[model samples]
Target: MTTPVLNTVLVRCSHTYQDELTVGDTKLLLDTTFRPEWHRKISAEVVAVPRKLNTRHTAYRGLKLGEIKAGDTIYFHYFGLTKENRLDTEDQDLYAIPYHEIFCKVREGVISALNGWALVEPVEVKSGSAWIGTDSEKISTQEGILRFIGHPKTDQPALNVQAGDRVVFSKNADFINTIEDKDYFIMQQEDLLATQPQKANEIESDYAGPRHYYETSPFYLSPDHD
Candidate 1:
């Protein structure tokens, strides 16, 4: 029962492993133990959290603090957690995660991106000919559809785009996050361009020689703004 200091959260991580490896042939074979992948962002159980600055608690009932709770399942970058912030225990290892470092929360098998991050599926643009022997080609559009968005923050206004909206963005924003088995881009609110209609926009242009890339921008009144 440790009440984390400040807005930090104390969590116990869940371990994932790959199957054992067998080396050598027949009689001289050796079986290697399961290898742990601690390098990736892993899920963890919230042990405790301090709701206030430099606060402590003897016991927390539901362990609920703001949107975080004691027993809630959340994701964090374990390999990225600094060595000074980790603690070891006989039962399970514990980590002190900054309130903003919480990747997302897992609730009833559904994941909601947190800390102003939004989950998106990149739209696949392709070209193909109807000819029987022709092969299809994939183009990098740098565009995606908005999926689940994180909770609203007090300091930021609501984003212009919502779930199911098509948006254009730059190459890669942040590290890719995988949920279940599907990979989604964890994008910040500022990286998103204005939402476009579901139907593709075919803007006319004179430079039509293999336009494989796409770019987006927000409207601004200031000309000097870069």
Candidate 2:
């Protein structure tokens, strides 16, 4: 008698019984969480492809199996499929990284830098200084990098930086703080404030305007005249 050939396929899946998972356990937990939804949208044959980490993936709004593809690998603790503020955290409802870091392998997918801080390019300071005087006061046009103090809506407490204050850019200190051949806004050392540790709970409102949950806040007209 002839024996029949058997086809063996290893399907990957994972999930959590608890609220959060240790980073070390994530890989082992993946295969168990794989669901029918994984191949509902895309052909099931594509799941065999190997995926790299720290890259982008297709982000869907819900857990609909019909929307996912075979090659797609889910990176838990990241952005939600379609929702604006939902992310992979203890509180799925709480807002985190607004920009989604999509997997580059997936078609029609875009990726984000996934950085917390924004870049403030160099600005031109008048006469290599920020201050002049009333009659002789020099004006600075849009020439230098403006440090991203904070979001106007989320920072309600008010943190202020004057024209002549120096700030150390977290990402690029030497390039940002020093003067180059081109005119830039390098505040004199005397005018700069020493860096102070900000409390996590404390919102930076001075530079940015006010702190309000973007989804819940109402629209308001500009109170100040131009």
Candidate 3:
């Protein structure tokens, strides 16, 4: 019998924030501002595809089955620009090379580049699925992912996302697990806070009322002006 090709693949995304912030003040802030009804409306625009049944046969085997195809964009939500004071002694051995040694090598200019090997303190991982195909393709057993963050509501235009445009989202977290090898969570487009061009802008523009605001102040402002 031929191996059944599953419609969805598992992905591992790094945790974006520290545990202290997520559980303490950060979570509180998100709980206060997040409006479920508004987010649901945003998610409705993106068509949901039927997910294949979770079975032993469908579990992630390797890269051929895991490679992200065109139209699919993995939304990585992790803590950015925060100090991690927690001492992670238990998972020290999980590193192939000691953290100190890697730091030394990098400082000495011995290692020029570090990709996934570089560790983020208090790292949390999550995964989700998005179907890029239309009704016909969804019905068929096609394999692919779409690369676009949905357009935000009129009030949230600071998200500044245009349809078919790739974006990076940033926001604080609630609670994140420190034990899971890979943290996985199914995410919808509505969960996004702010978005900017995934890649560098090809064209330059001087007008900057609020095309893409990174600060929380600008984020809360009305997008109607710009």
Candidate 1's displacement at residue 171, Å, is: 3.3
Q: Is candidate 1 or candidate 2 better by TM-score?
A: 1
TM-score of each: 0.63, 0.17, 0.17
Arranged by TM-score, best first: 1, 3, 2
Candidate 2: deviation at residue 45, Å? 27
59 Cα displacement, candidate 2 (Å): 24
Better of 2 and 3 by lDDT: 2
Encode model 2's per-residue lDDT on 68-139: one tens digit a residue. 234433222222222442234443432222122211112234211111222233422333334222111242
TM-score of 2: 0.17
Give the winner by TM-score: 1
The sequence of per-residue lDDT tens digits that candidate 1 reaches over residues 145-221 is: 77878755544667877888877765556345555545566666667767777754332122122211111224322
**Across residues 33-124, which tens digit of lDDT does each residue of candidate 3 receive?**
24322111100000111133233332221112222222232222222111231124442211111111111012221211111111111111
Candidate 3 overall lDDT versus native? 0.23
User: Model 1 TM-score?
Assistant: 0.63
Cα error of candidate 1 at position 55, Å: 14
lDDT of each: 0.56, 0.25, 0.23
